[model samples]
Target: MKRREFIASAAPLGLLFSLGLGDVPFANAQTAGGTPVPGGVLNVAVSPEPTLLTSAFITTMNIGQVSSKILEGLVSYDLNLQPVPALATSWSTAPDGLTVTFRLRQNVKWHDGKQFGAADVQYTLLEVWKKLHPFGRAAFANVTAVDTPDPHTVVIRLSSPAPYLINYINTYGAQILPRHLYEGKDVLTNPVNNAPVGTGPFVFKEWVKGSHVRLARNPDYWQKGQPYLDGVVFRFIPDAAARTVALEAGEIDVALGSSIPLSNLNKFQDKSRYSINLDDGRYLATIFLTQFNVRKPYFADKRVRQAFAHAIDRNALLKVVFLGYGKPATGPVPSSVVNYYAAQTRQYPYDLKKAAALLDEAGLKPGKDGKRLRIALDYDAGGGVTATRPAEFIKQSLARVGIEVELRGGDTASYLRRVFTDQDYDLMISSLHRLPDPTLGVQRLFWTRNIIKGAPWTNGSGYSNPRLDTIMEAAGREADVARRRALITEWQQIVQEDVPVLDLVEQTWVTVSTARFQKTALQGDGLFASYADAWLTPKKA
Candidate 1:
């Protein structure tokens, strides 16, 4: 059974709209007849508030969910996952695959009333993404230059063939930013990050702290007569049960990111009241793993890392923690991404005896108090039960082997800073997306160059292997498909042997919404889409 789905409205508007809450704006939205209605608010439930609006630098799921609507990518993917036009009308690649060119759409303007052009794309790629973006550091490593012949034409020059470069030009990945605003400023600390300006279907309205983020429709949207809904309000409901109850009560129209607990999904199984999506808007193929601070002397030993892997039972973690929503992962890449996934590598089946022996070999024997070593474990507080439960489970499992774990947690914003920026964690638990391609997702987690401070979803472990880096860099530039796959396989094996981080499970999340919502499934990403064409139908007569 497909475990994850989102919730949309099938009934009429709730009392919240009738009472008139302008601070968190909502409307009596949707169609009267068969045609889609132009006016109404699509109230969405986003569990944790995003740290910022734009996903150009930080690819946090919540950030992508909201920012995708405001920021327009050069292209958007089709139902077949093929690149289609968004900001860039047309594009071409050189025979050698080293040079690619894009023709920007004319008459398109940024949210701040500036003309969108090649200069915006050029600066976003070279200055922002390459320098600051966690994944872009690895994905766009070979990018030598982004030349703009005219205001509408952008020519990208690469040092080697990057066949997978086209896959990440979408809004959720390499979002285009305005050159005028970001020209001579510190991007990370820029005030505009809190209130983004973009070229998309939605305009930046207001974000009430610890409340909701409200967005209004962009009247000057490049797509003609589209983005049918008037606006969107993503409410922050911290509790999973409360989010589900709100959806059931019609307070919120939709809920994505599996905010509702898996055990509660049966209540919404009645198709008449609720609609479900399996593989839609879920471009993020998530891998739930624990990253260790390898800089610490206790965790630096290879045997210690291997012992930690053997200590945890992956099968039990899948069944108990995730409620069997996913399968145990083999390596960095999950089985869902069949193109590059490595089927065979070193396996760490549950073996208490082996775990104890390995720990002893690493000179981490039980002391007078029966404690081998003490460590702190941090987790994403926003992930609700899914994240919190796993931390507890790992702690329990590791306890049997004489390792004492102190669970640490905080808000999503502070958690990212603690682990990635401060590097304050001994062991950090995070569920990160492996994206559509390994170059865009998997490589960033292990690549030496991607251990950037203040960047989330990066190599915070401080682990580096020159051979693995060589393999990853070659795979990124490799033109031949078979050769690239082989290189990727080798990369997985090296990580498995080194055990920098324990790749636990590959999760398949769901999106639940009502049938009244339209055009959400048009894009391959499902609920993670820009929602430009998304609108609601009228209540059942």
Candidate 2:
């Protein structure tokens, strides 16, 4: 299997982050030093310090949390998966529907006291479209050009009537940047990644590397009298247990991206210290699995891949690895994304007999010398949520079908380097975050170009299929979403039959917070999309 073929066959379940800079003195939210109504600071514990801080290149949750607060996108997705105004108050499409014009909000002002205009909007798209800088390539992939007609009106010209462009534009990667501050080579070493300036509700305060990042309210923010909290602080805590402990001890006001173990869920729920919200379907979901390198002789045959998939006992896996929170995956696209995902579409039920049968069919028989199919699996153990136990359960399940599973664990930095840059794994097990736009979600993992040999973002499995490639490209350029979804379903069908990737389960995420924080929702996409609309209820202390 070629590198692109591997990506197309792999099922994706992951998220990313970015970082940028700006630094004003850190001021305590406490009403001291003559700052009126010094608001209470909300403390957040993050897992790691982000590598890239720019809106275009953020690849982890740690950097995303900070960037979201400091930056604003042209459009924003609401809880119901609808687009709403952000930097742009309203927009209209040209007669051909390929050109879109957006009118910016008049009162918006950057944190640095600079007035935001169409020039900034035009500059951002132009810089990102050129791909001369890092991370800008992914932000505006379908954009052909951008035009700023006036101070408050911006137009975007598309290569085609791309259906998923709206959804893609509102994501973390497309956050509008300050054109003046980030132009030319200066962006390579821009100070904004460590300290950012934006027109969001919060303004950058300070960042103590390896410790915490601080943000203060933008008094003259575009939205009047918003962001009730005077400031917010994100504290970096790599350990999940430590994050839970801090929340209970009041050391932090909110904890994101970490899970409270299922065994401890009942205990925590009974206590009033915090409220637990679990979308079991969305949070505790499909078991995490690996995409075998079809390029290898042992797994090259379709029968071998199918045999390996059938060998794993998903029923036992849910009980042991997920603690009964999630269920076995029926197909590549989770049931949460579509209601019609049924056994008829794709179901690799656990049948040891069938697995052994397929193994024999593939010409791999148990030899007298006890030689069996032995494959090394790479697993990231850098902490957070998924790495805790699922990987071990996967190893045990694969062991039953004459496959010797060697599970390798490493630090975060080393794990990413090996997976993305080195192409050094026979089997890889990593979690993915699904998006409403299946084309964007699926393409990110399966597109052949994303995994060119030696490229950092290569989808390591090296399983490729041409049919999938045609379907993905067609779906991306489709103008009608209904048609796009149909094409995506077709693409999903191809991925399921290929067996290069064995999707174990769809993981669910639980958010434990105070009930007083009304309108706080962890969207299915796992983003605080409507956070700005959230307001604290005075009904609770």
Candidate 3:
């Protein structure tokens, strides 16, 4: 049976059991009024609290899984990563592809009991452009302004023609936030931060700090007879082992981010007792890289940078760090991103002999004591086991090349603030989780002026090229699809050669849930996909 149809038939029984309204005939779930047939609290486990609730700062998979449940973007991605309509019924782009106008659905309502309107679009665009909200700023960076001609119509004017504009607008950065609540002072600390209101199928009810969050069903959801469960509870479990344990023990209904290590992959798969969704490589996960402080004297020369890339065994490190979970990437863009990512692009293969030669070429040869180049390697140790091990492995590999490397680690928040954002490190390992488009990622990291004081979100590499900057600008405004792609490919080539950010691996996400919860039917650019029609079956009740 289809996942939705199967859920519709089984939800009543599960709801009856979950809500403790059991022994009542399952047929009574079919009420005449068709009001919310409520039951059950879907207990879930999330990893950590995101810096910000809105898409702007949703870096971790846990945050994406949680926010996706609460906020509904205008456009959502299908399993194949295709754009599908969500809030806006349909949209059309001008022939030039520089301007896009959307026809908003008139009947949608915000979770705070207010009518959702075009003003929400204006607020979101301005905030993203001005504040650097993390969900995705590059996607909307070229948008000159947003215009609302009517209550149900919104028009976006771009600086350049972009065929993929609609797809980007449907991403997380374009998520609609309630203007009425976030417009005033202390908006950051408003109860809404902890508790958000959205037009999505789920409504935020409670958040137990450092543990789990709860979301009740929105009876007034735009889509009728949807949101099969009464509510969804998201629990936070940082440890992958504990998360898997909770899932197997039924302490949690589902485990969202399942990039579990290979050693533990079988622990979840070995058990035929529980239904597991083995979607090892759903999306083209972006690269994990180390950015150097070009402003520092030690790494000022291009030869020094080239030497560093050549010193490390990327293939061996990939296997050790990911345990064969991912593939080593050669450039900023992943292979999955077609039209722009070229496989033939130059890659700096590992060779200690060449690395030593480059160091000599850069005039950073070893002293009489035989101690070669020394540099500080910093990483955000706050990601628990996932962040620490790879960081240590990178250090060890660098040492093998006779390079003196110092390991500096700190809490996630402090590290991101003092080291990365402040540009106070020699070298650091970091990863950008989401890149809807290749240009979006490149623009954020390489745009010259974007590295200024207020816009220091990216550019951690402290590397920029005037030629590439102009190409990025022209590409952003170029309306011709073919020409735009050509520019993107050229820019990527420049980035790869500069080696400001040494590309590493493309991660894979895994998910495990009960068979009652449909697997293939998941949707959107998140781990949970969509729960609009998801339902849990009762356990032999």
Candidate 4:
């Protein structure tokens, strides 16, 4: 079956929006109708050099934003958060919904000049995606086989129906890798990861470790006359204040992951010089959470987790830490995911008396020193003040309930190792990007099968509820949209009652860009976009 044939046959699931041209406007680009001038470099500010260049293993958004320019997936989400074609020209699903076929685009070449075909997709799905990807393991759990009948045709046969498979393939799901290069080599230690070869708009050039990573435009890009800029340079700033200073001084053209300090956002309101885009965050669904390690004796009790939840006030965290840039989250899924979000779930109101009562009921009584117990809490310092400030606030709140928290702050790598690998920390304050669907993001938080020992972002909390797991599995296979949503709602209620992970706040990301750049449309997925769609505007004399 062809791409158009599938679209015509399958009824619209309401999740698929209209493919209108430029339906979602770029947050702050000057769209006033001047010709796009090419051949200039676009400078971006990134914090803390990414430990891994491969998106298959990366936990932080910094690495994905940088690597996206070098790697092209089978599909990408547009500004409206709808699935759009990338490497695959079109796709169709079987009548039973257990099979999916993708029609590849011809003449697409990898950076190494080799033809991109079905084999590349097959290898990426079997080796990297199904086995190694954090979200893919659960998303593709029902996949029985991936068949490539021809060079341009790829078919996926599943044991059951997966409605959200297309959504995953659009974002982190289907990043195609060259089978010839990664087939027989150690994928984790492959040299190609440091210097990648992809079919993206930019070609990998050089990396100067902790300083910067550079990329040149791909002249032979599939989208002809694209990647308007000559090159792109990502500068590692680490400090949010320093990133804002660089943007103000015109040292950088754009900030990738909203590294600019929230207090300094008002200073860049000049229309002619800078464009500040505080996006609606529909595509970039992120939920700030306080994760508990149920493996620890102190946190194994549900009462203790509920006590901590009632102690901390999410509204205060929004104002004090985010500067009123986000909303208080209710569950693992953020409000931006409108289809499956259950707003009526259990809410934890801030009450010190209730918190104290619950702690006492859990048998955690204070000693003569007036401290119930001491627990270690860690936060990611790479997120700058946004992360550290919240940790400080949580420490103060937990102390009021007689639970002493030793706050520990570290870089992205250290925090990942402690929580994911070592599993030594008692509590962790971190943010996870909630995808458009619950199956893509929320399932990994509580799924028992996803509790991979060495994995960085998959069920690190070691949380598993048999009832919730069954609901998640049924939701993945349910073809009826309403039935799947009902299943998701049931799972949310269970998670709220269980209190495995406490939802804190949903953040709103702000991206700042210089007026020298044009057509800078920030997609729903986050601040980053295919630089190919962006062009440099000529400066006035």
Candidate 5:
């Protein structure tokens, strides 16, 4: 696809009317603003206080949402889902495509007032990203070394061309960390994880455990007169109903990650106090998934996996669980990713008879109770009703096919431990941000090499297909957009057939904010946004 076509295709669905611009696009709405009034605390509602503050260790959207205020990557995705400058002022790739050079922004200071330069970017990529980040390890697998020619320039040398490296860096893979603070210490356990220091708009002030995380504006922020709010307070309200009540009662300025229940979305739709955006746009590339542990005997058989897929009623689940806020997903990549999304792939329509036949064909016979087999299902309770309700619905649907599902739930930590670390569950229902490019987000979920023992959100399924692996690797290395897209189409076909992870629904994540907050430019979902450019409009007298 041409650059302009791709940008338009990836742009957000139309702006909701609550913004009062009469259907103007969000990007254009920013330019229609009055003078930005600075000096008010933007209270945000986030479910389940973040377990970790650093994106270097885990890539959870919740952590990124909170950390983006204080931390910054080398590049960030604009409203069109295209990589734009962030900490790096400019960057260019060599003719051979094996090298990328970045020119750093000079005079930018970390939250601790230290100079932000090449060494920090070098350390972040070499020590942290390549070795630890879930997506980074795959995206930068071919990066041979990072060279700092001067104090303000970085040149990345790769063994082979990696077409998607820049996209990964722009997303969550390359969140720059200060070399001064973590150079000699235990990077993972360093105290800076809780009290992080970065060159972003906000300064880490205090984190009151179990209540809220508070951040104050950085007076010396490199971008002049930005980060209009005096501070931002992320209130930890785990209950979806409570978050809705808070938004309704004017207790919070914005609800991050669409924490409010979908059932209650209409409550605030036309309210004069708030506006709601439910299109999910290019910024929030995500899909609800039903992942299987391929190592387990029950799910090891592709027939059984296909049977389970047929048992799911995605349209009904969309209506009941998401309250018609999403579309039935056909595969791993969402339709919003227009460039590489494969529409011709095989689809599993809801059919209990077909599901039962597949189960019987797989050598499974129903018992006296008309149940074929028993297995455990798990999901993260911290995701609020959105995740939990879908798992419940799946359980009931699977039971109809003579599969007895034992439903389980836990907080975020336990969920990560059980699924990613322990590999304790037979099935897991979860959602993952699909990202604008497949290499940045999707590969890690299925690639065998990414099956890290303790890493959260890696390939926990223990699935390994040599052909699929080769296609993925080739796709990453291919610089030609047309050839790369064709390879991606083939990869999606294999994934849909393998059933390593069953795609359920493409969520239309709803983000609601009070009318007082204006020009909220979201960065990849509402999980992260350009808060520094966000300004608050004055309240009526």
Candidate 6:
């Protein structure tokens, strides 16, 4: 089927997103009441088959949703989003903030049975993460060396203090990989990315492409006899309503990342039969946006970009499309991401008159055909309501200001290739995650050095501002909270003035599971959590 026709045929779930996906039901999802019994396979539903199974070099949410189960990181986060121990038993930073050291947990074995130690930490930090991780290239740029004093001790020496460093040690941001396998292999194409070996609770079993990725529990998991389900099977179901049907018919036990249509959630209201989880996604707070390819001639001027921002009716988009599920994003930092969020950053409301004047002033006046310029809107295929409604809304909104719109869509792999790898779109709409910290997740979107070709989720806009780059560098290296906060404030203001990408709305996320699912989402990352402690209640409940 053609990409344009994909949206037309997609069944819209509309305005019925999830609650506690930043709504009033913001409490941690309650589990079924009973003595937790283990041994059943935890069937997890994931939409759009993921392209890869590891996050060592890539950080797509779909990939992380599954890969984190196999590849563990140095630390995990708490309900409060504070760093907690995982593979690293304890960690400390020098008073100067340049030297950080961690004591590795002993007796840990990679899924392949190799003893996990400091060498793996040293190699992962220096090799794949520092160079290939989409966000790590900017986040870990100051790391000068990783010193392994022994099998259990690893020291990270940085050229400058990176106050944002610790926050990124979570599995999704800096997932540690085994060096014995990747040391001499091509990290990007290493067969291990497709079939991973790690120290997490689950072992990579097999990935039957176009179908599912199965993971068996690690009997030798460092956590000890945990991840109580006998195994986990992530099923790939592309249709939205079909996922809802699977959940209803017991074909799948749980749906994380809102793969199931939320409007149907009301059917599972029997507390004994099911539960909804929303509290644990704080670590992956996200913003939906339409980013311009500033390298293009029509978007070369900042006024043209700002005009595009003004043409967006964000409030209407939230009301009509999002159905009060989220707020209009005022800046790059979503309000859900606390600290360093500049609430007072400049805002562009829906003003067609202002939009038209900005375009005219930039010398892009309407032609005899009543259009200033024609541009293609590119986005991933089959995002259900989120992608389809927003693309059409933006296209119609731009038409009002004398801009002609052409819609473009592709499957997951092709869309990422076109936008981030090929840099092929005039404007593209996708959700960008602002991880627990801005320096860890947000800087890569605007920093000049992050414009590496073929890197998914990096700076694809070709926006370069030396002043903003310097401020971001200082913000990353600044150990003082007040100083870093001030720098982030300036960074937010400058990006607005430049208008490289239009921040659309804070995204809504959700998870659904039968009441039998136990101890799955107690951490800040929630469903994205490695599920090390996740278990299941006996079927007879």
Residue 86, candidate 2: Cα error in Å is 1.8
- Better candidate by lDDT, 1 or 2: 1
Over 134-195, each residue of candidate 1 has an lDDT whose tens digit, in order, gives 66776687899999999999999999988788878888779888889988999888888878
RMSD of each: 8.0, 8.0, 9.6, 7.6, 6.0, 4.2
Give each model a TM-score.
0.81, 0.84, 0.83, 0.86, 0.86, 0.86
**lDDT, candidate 5, 1-541, per-residue tens:** 0111111111221112111222222212112255788899999987657877878756766677788889888888865567778888899989888999999999999888789999998998989989887667777888899999998999999998888777767435568899999998888899999999988899999999999999998999988888899999999886667888898888998886556654566677554567665432355466768899999987889999999999998878766665444567889887777778999998999998999999999988799989889999987665444455677899999989888999888876788789889989899876666777887678878888888887777788989998999999888888888999999999999999988999887754456788787764554433565488777788799
- Give lDDT tens digits, candidate 6, residues 1-541: 0122112223232222222244532223554245556687889887667888888787666788899999989988876678899999999999888999999999999887789999999999999899988668767889999999899999999999988888888888889999999998898888888999988888989999988999998888887668777889999888778888888888888887766554566677777778776555667666778899999987989999999989989878877775655667788887666677788877888899999999999999999999999999988765655577788888999999999999987777888788878898899987766776888878888989889898777788989999999999888888888988999999999998888989887754567788778784377677568877777776783
TM-score for candidate 2, please give it: 0.84
Looking at candidate 3, the ten consecutive residues that score lowest on lDDT are 9-18
lDDT of each: 0.77, 0.61, 0.63, 0.76, 0.76, 0.79
* Poorest stretch of ten by lDDT in candidate 6: 1-10
Tell me how far the alpha carbon of residue 337 in candidate 6 is from the true structure, in angstroms, after superposition.
1.8
- Lowest lDDT sum, 10 consecutive residues, model 5, at 1-10
| Candidate rank order under lDDT | 6, 1, 5, 4, 3, 2
Model 6 clash tally, residue pairs: 0
Error of 3 at 291 (Å): 1.6
Stretches > 4 Å off in candidate 4: 1-35, 51-60, 280-284, 296-298, 360-374, 380-386, 410-424, 452-454, 526-528
Question: C-alpha displacement of 332 in model 3, angstroms?
Answer: 0.5
Off by over 4 Å in 6: 1-35, 50-52, 181-195, 206-211, 262-271, 295-301, 356-374, 382-386, 410-425, 452-456
Residue 176, model 3: Cα distance from true site in angstroms: 1.1
lDDT of 6 at 255: 84
